[model samples]
Target: MSLKVAVIGCGSIATHRHLPEYAANENVEITAVCDIVGERAEEAAAKYQAKAYTDYKTLLKEESIDAVSVCLPNYLHAPVSIDALNTGAHVLCEKPMATSIEEADKMIEAAERNGKKLMIGHNQRFVASHQKAKELIESGAIGKVYSFRTAFGHGGPEGWSADGKESWFFKKDEAFIGAMGDLGVHKADLARYLLQDEFVEVGAFVETSAKENTDVDDNATLILKSAKGTIGTLAASWAYTAKEDNSTIIYGEKATLRLEDDPTYSLVAQYANGETVKYELGAIQSNDEGGQTTTHVINHFIEAIQNNTVPLIDGIEGKKSLAIILGALESVKTKRIYSLEK
Candidate 1:
């Protein structure tokens, strides 16, 4: 029984990650591709052998879709996702759940109202190296994790967005917050997932240092303190023109773990007792380097629907992570530590 899936907003994310992954998944049949840009939608449809739609509402009304991937701009995420949910389809929305907590709440409500699964596309959780690192941390191999520094940086979305420099990602109105929303949120989610704890306080400095003619910030540094007393820095930058830096360092009582930092190894463990071990999980997926082994996000989403189970990164989990980034933005605005409780 193949699940019929439709992709809304046939942008770079859909083209690069979702559509390809779904094409590979035998459990899903891509029934439709929709985008405001007719050509983009038609192009994807022609390649995937699915129907092309310029209006998502029309697609939702006509297509017999079991699930949909909402890859629209930051502002439209909530509205479009809610519409898809109301149309009786599970939604796998792209990151930074919504511009506001209120919007995220509505999205969750819509899914519950429709009895459909709503999974956020926080693909970092499904990365192979990240999965292995999580396993090691949970196994107590790191021994009482005390601190960490996780970062996601690249040349910027201009180099990757389907529309390039003219994309909505550069518009403050469409994007809301810049690199923090685009890249930092992923690290914020990853930190919460890896630490197995919620971030309680956030202090951040966000600014636009690179990419001219854009109001959005390109570089950001966030100081995060977990509920369990662990503190770390989460950085997001679009100024890494030299190369991408998607690395995390977790320091515990027994050892310090480095992820995606070294050219030779993906995971490196340096122990206090003078022992070094490297785990060869493989490279973290980068936009420039397109050989991503598999995200497994689509696979997990399909399985959850098939098994009547919850997706790993559900709406609530998505909201919690989104809250951290929101807090960071608040921190930048007010020049104060934004506490999650407030």
Candidate 2:
């Protein structure tokens, strides 16, 4: 039987990643598409031959959905996902799992109580270059990892959002965060995945300098200390006017590994012995160009449900990543190193 899937948002992420990927999967059926904007919902539903709903609560109550992708604004992630889970449907929630840890915990608890799979849409972890980098790092390609720096930046979300400049991406109440939640959370999660460690301490200087007509941050720089004593810098911004910079460089005792840093190579390694190796794995998906490719998030979520296994980026993993961004926000307010242990 095909998995009856429903997408609760008709925004950029839903249109680009979830809907297309699910539609392409033979084992999946797009049963419904919902959006507050009736036209957007109708358009997506018409394209996928699914029912259109202006309200997600109505969709949940009416449709016999086996799985759901909660792609709403940051504030709605937890409530929508918890509702879907309570309705006995697995949920694939977008990144920045929730506005708060309490909400994240509720989403996780709902999934567990209902025996459903809850996955976060952190696509960076599933990138080809990232996967290969993880394998190489585990194989001692760079020896003992010491420190690193990672960044994810673009012009802004104005062009990408369905609502353009008036989108919820810039609203403090709706997004609860700006660059950090939009881009920083991904790097935080990626760093954890790559290093196989947890961040214990975070300090940051977050600001809303670039964009006008918004109170949320458009730039942020974070310093992180991992549980294993590894330290690194993470930069997330909407102020990169030239080009997107989704890259990470890890320094180790024997060598350095760079992912998505070079224009030509996806992964590059420079050894202390003056040896250089470049792996043309694949291009990292960017907001401006070459992002049409499948993110592998929806397919992986489906497989996890079908196989009765945990998703690679499960609820707990999502919360861990969210905690980092939350910690960074707290650091900004307190002007002190935010400890994740607390």
Best by lDDT: 2
The candidate scoring highest on TM-score is 2
lDDT (tens digit, per residue) of candidate 1 on 145-182: 99999989989988899999999999999998889899
Tens-place lDDT digits, model 2, residues 1-342 = 799999999999899788999999999999999999999999999999999999999999999999999999999999999999999999999989999999999999999999999999999999888998888789997888999999999999997888989999999999999999999999999999999999999999998899999988999999999999999999999999889999999999888998999999999989999999999987777777635777899899999999999999999999999999999989989999999986
Query: What lDDT does model 2 reach?
Result: 0.94
- TM-scores of the candidates are 0.98, 0.99
- What are the Cα lDDT values of the candidates? 0.92, 0.94
Please give the RMSD to the true structure for each candidate, in Å.
1.0, 0.8
Give the clashing pairs for model 2: none
Which parts of model 2 have CA positions greater than 4 angstroms off? none
- Show model 1 residue runs off by greater than 4 Å: none
